[model samples]
Target: MTSLKLIFSLFIISFYSCSYVYAADLKKLAIEEFKKANYPKAIEILEHALIENNDDLELYYCLGYFTHYLCYDSVPLTGFDIRKSDEVLAYLGKAVELKPSYGDAYYFIGAEYGVRARRHLGKGEVDRAVFEFRLAREKGGLPDWLIEYGRNNLKTCDRDAILFTGGDADTNPIEYLQLVENYRRDVTVIPIALLNRPWFVQMIKYGIENAINAAPISWSREQIHDMHPYKWKTNLILIAVPETIKAELQIDKDFEWELEPDFEGRLSAGAAVLADIVKTNQWARSIYFSVACHPGMYHGLGDFFQSCGTTYRLIPTQTKDTELELDIKCIEDVFMDGDNYKSIASVADNNMPRASHMLNNYRAALFRLLIHYYKDKNKRRAKEVLDFMESTIREEYVASGALGEHLASYRKLLE
Candidate 1:
């Protein structure tokens, strides 16, 4: 009896060990496919892994994430059309079921609604979109990449300003501030991609109970350019413009229109609305734009907007002669390396998007900011910032492969 029991115990151990190794191998491959933007292949790998073990928590989360990415990126699945968003929701729902306490799961679910809202804006689905984002607020509060992105982007703005933006990457954290942490309670987050859609404009008006002037809800895309409608007492914040839209914008209207050709992507109705806001605002409330906003949105006013950390504070063109205050506060917040991203890199899956973003956007941005300060002749502050960066770049970032070895080389030059 003892010998038989021993054999059974060994068999069980061997089986689970093999199972774990297989799952690990599969996850690694799936992550690679995801990075390549080969969503179909990535999904196939995860689905096979699921067949091997349905209860794998990380597998479910990753499957949901990749599947959502496919639809979000407008890559239609062979049979499951991108319009069939519920399929994407189910995978995410499973992730939530497996780990209810995880705030990231909730954030992804809310993002699906944001995605769905953008698609169904014409169908008058704004209420449902608002509801899901609000639900995300209830569930999301963890300090992850998206939350940090939102916080860093908004830190430059005045308290209680309505900050307009778009994308799960950008807007989710802003919503996190309002709904979860209750930190920036009054700032209204408007996703500008949705603003490109006429129905969404009307929906925002109804859902937020804000009176948007000259919204042009009834106008067609082509007709939108003719009206000058955006007139609100509150300041206008230009959040984001899609690259495709940006490419279409006309950078400038030369005084000699006969000699100069008109550029293609001049805001049309969207740009017209911004022009009205520009005219009406008179800098009443502080007009700010996140640095992430496309340059096309500047419409010849690029010279007036100066980078202050993750955002641009609008300085009047007349002030080109006057010196502007250095935003020490923004630099301090963005570049501060109180604790490194060691814990995040150690635990994050091989292909986790947040880990890469942390390295690329936050860490790289800090490195550049260090150079900027030094070049601007603020040596003391530059050294102070460098010290904070040095603390993290070696062990937390360099020892681990989260950052390239080149960054270490860059540090040597900076010193």
Candidate 2:
């Protein structure tokens, strides 16, 4: 009898483990419902799944996404109800509490808040919108597109050329045009600063040298024997790429290299250089570059920017693709006018003191460029963008922090 009881207990434990293992799959089913535009079905399944596994962290995360996506679908025109948004935000908040590491949870919470803040615009809620957008960038993993959108909107808000101020003396056409040109110019040249970055260059050289020496190359016996010559020659060539690229591009690498040591370094140097140009002319300013982080650079791209004291762009570079763009555009159009993405137009109109937000938008715009290019190619960059969804009491989605931490890891799995 005791042996039979023990066997029964073992069977029960196995069943429990199996269920948990399959939970993500079940949750995905609900996500499919979402994909098919069956929000009600998705919500229903998610609710049921959540009920069954109340402690499932991912379930909560998915529930948050379902609500967040719905919110995303509502914007300036179609519009989202603040009351409905509150419910979704509550779920997202719960998801974060259950799984603090769940980056998506944090992101959705911020996004929901951003919409609310925007909705409250002109009603003493501009500050609230800024707060929500900041949070969304922090947690949802700001991709370059989002940052650019936000940044442009911010510029619009600050410059006030298009609306509100009605093109006053401060919003002189030539002056505002110059501002746009200057900001765009800064973005086009961002890669120059990034590639010829001293620390980044130095680190890449080191890695390449090491990789070359260790790389299985077909070396002649004499060449192999002379390790000293090989090492010296390899190091020289490795260090030369930055200079070579700069020369070919006709860019001033030396000047960009000098703008390093921290984000402040970049911001201060840029501001200092442009001080006489912009009327305000602040001595030291913080410029936020909304960069999609990539691992190809020695320091994750974000850190490289931060190293110069520039605020890091709050987006992930890897996820940029045609589908994602469509997802955003579709969502954007669902809520706002198809062409009007000037959510931050208010900030620019106000002549906001800081230009950090403008910088972030530049980064995001660049990301859109990359995404546009990626869409033109026939290559399959991301290997594991699964079509599967999970089952839950509410809309549940599963995201792995470990998986999204670095580019190499993502390439390995995604490719």
Candidate 3:
């Protein structure tokens, strides 16, 4: 009986070893497919792997993550399938069950909840939307560094400003700050992509009419709901740029400029709404675009964007000859000052992919500052920026990334 039991135990060990190896190989293959944007193929590979290794934590997490990408990134190509959302939650739920301490899984789970919240909001289910938003914040498991980054971005705007955010990383954390921490409650946060939806426009209009948190919109309910892209015949005129902004950009007092639409000669729905808001708001409230936003999202107003920390404020005056200008004082005051700098400097290298993306944004901002100071021949300040980058952003993140190449070139420039 003892000899039989020993042989059985050896056989069990061999079976599990082979299963582990096979699961690892499947994960590798699925990741390769994911990297190539073959999300469906990646999901298929993971599903097949899970059939044999249902308890594999990594497999479940990958399935959840890849399904999310399929739903989000490929929506135009594959239509928004409700079934996929159910699949994502199920896979991620299994992942969490397998490992309760899985932070990445938790983050994505929060992101999925955020998506549902937006859908609920779009459907005018305010209570459900708020509930899901709160749930998203609770489940996010966001790192301190990312939260500080959101706070830093919020600090850039004046009171009652309208801030437009770009992606999940930028928008979600800011929402978390506002919802959970009660930070920057006066500022209205709008995600640019959501402007494409008529329901979102109606919602904003309702808020504006009811004197809710939204910035005032001049468009009537019908107009806002039916708003679409149109060509502008006149150049955007600016009555005056704030003197403080002028001093920051070193612009002459008499310098005046008008913004013309890009060569496309057409505005997107989001840009049209933004243009109208800028025209109607008339500097009563500051309008900002998060640094995470693409330049294309600027809607031909790129030249007027003034860098204030991690956000770009639209100023009435344009730079004379510079492609980009930084508000050095603002950066020094908000981003690199006491508590904020401490949060950034003390960020742990947790190796979270989302955290890495946020860190790259910081690195990009610092790189811009480094170039600005270097070109101005302020070697001391440039060196300070470079040192900060080296110290805060790990060498591993910079070794082969695009930022690495930029840093190498700048180091040569400094030398």
Models 1 onward score TM values of 0.55, 0.36, 0.73
Q: Give the Å shift of residue 50 in candidate 3.
A: 2.8
lDDT of 1 by residue, 231-306 (tens): 3332233433334433433222211101111135233445544444444444444556655555665555556554
Residue lDDT tens for model 2, 134-250: 554455434333343433432322121111111111111111222222332122112222122233222222222111111112323443233221111111101122454346435
State the displacement of the C-alpha of residue 349, model 2, in Å, after optimal TM-score superposition: 33
**Candidate 3, 81-110: lDDT as tens digits:** 568877887888888788876767867876
Worst 10 residues of 1 by lDDT: 253-262
Instruction: Identify the leading candidate in terms of lDDT.
Output: 3
Worst 10 residues of 3 by lDDT: 204-213
Clashes of each: 6, 54, 0
Model 2 weakest 10-residue run by lDDT = 229-238
| Best of the two (2, 3) by lDDT | 3
List per-prediction Cα lDDT, in the order shown. Answer: 0.55, 0.37, 0.72
Candidate 3 residue-wise lDDT at 72: 73
